[model samples]
Each structure stands twice: as structure tokens, then as C-alpha cells.
Target: MDNNGPAYHEMMELHEILNFKTLCLVKSKMMSGLVFDQDLKALMEKDVKQTTAAIQDLQSVYKPNGGIVH
Candidate 1:
């Protein structure tokens, strides 16, 4: 309430989003390796990169102990 950061509830919501993005990132990275089609692998790699950036942005906004979650 005093740190000018998001409210506790808002932080929790962001945490959920961060977790989901992280999962997507992980899955895409794994799937990209398993994909046989070059085009599909490229697409999954792109998704992994985008998800990594999204998670970084969310971490900047949702830091709880002045550290990135996970």
C-alpha cells in the first residue's frame, strides 16, 4: 500500500499471468525442438521469444521482493 506498486490483488493477477507465460515459453521451446517441419519450428521459436519478452515485462511490473519471480 505504501510502495506505490500494484495492490496485492493486482500483483497476484500478474503473478498468474507471469506463470502462464512462463509455461508457454517452456512448452514452445520444447515443442520447437520436437517439430519436424522447419516452418512450424520457426513459428514456435518466435512464440518462445515473444513469451520470454512478455514475462520479462511482467516481472518488471510485478516484482514482490524487488526480485523477479521464478
Candidate 2:
């Protein structure tokens, strides 16, 4: 088997989980109300932003020559 396989799978799984969490957060915000309280909305937005950044970072790391994976 290829040496990169396990790392690739783990990264993919992490990406999937992040996507799921983003979806859940969005749904919760919608269900809360059209106006969802400022504090909660802020928190959700922060989480989403951070998760998005993390996914982007992972993608960058996985890019050819990025050197994240052995």
C-alpha cells in the first residue's frame, strides 16, 4: 500500500467532520430564529470561520511539495 494512504484518509475524514459541523451550526442558527441572538450568532460565525481556515490550511499542507505528509 502507498505510504501516504493513511494520512490522506485521516485528512479526508477530518474534512468531512468539519463540513458536518459547519452544516449543523448553520442549521442551528436557522432553527434558532431568523434573528438568532447576537452572541450566539457571533459564536457560531467564529467557529465556522475557524473551521474554514483549518480546512484551507489542511488543503495547503496537502498540496504537492507542501511537505505536510511524509
Q: Once all C-alphas are superposed, what RMSD does model 2 give against the true structure? A: 4.8
Encode model 1's per-residue lDDT on 21-54: one tens digit a residue.
9988888988788899998988898888889899
Candidate 1 Cα lDDT to native: 0.80
State which candidate has the highest lDDT: 1
Candidate 1 stretches greater than 4 Å from native: 1-3, 66-70
Q: What Cα-based lDDT does every candidate model obtain?
A: 0.80, 0.62
**Model 2 alpha-carbon miss at residue 19, Å:** 5.0
lDDT of 2 by residue, 4-65 (tens): 44466666775676577667657755654664588877776676677667656666555443
Clashes of each: 0, 0
Question: Which one is best on TM-score?
Answer: 1
TM-score of each: 0.82, 0.46
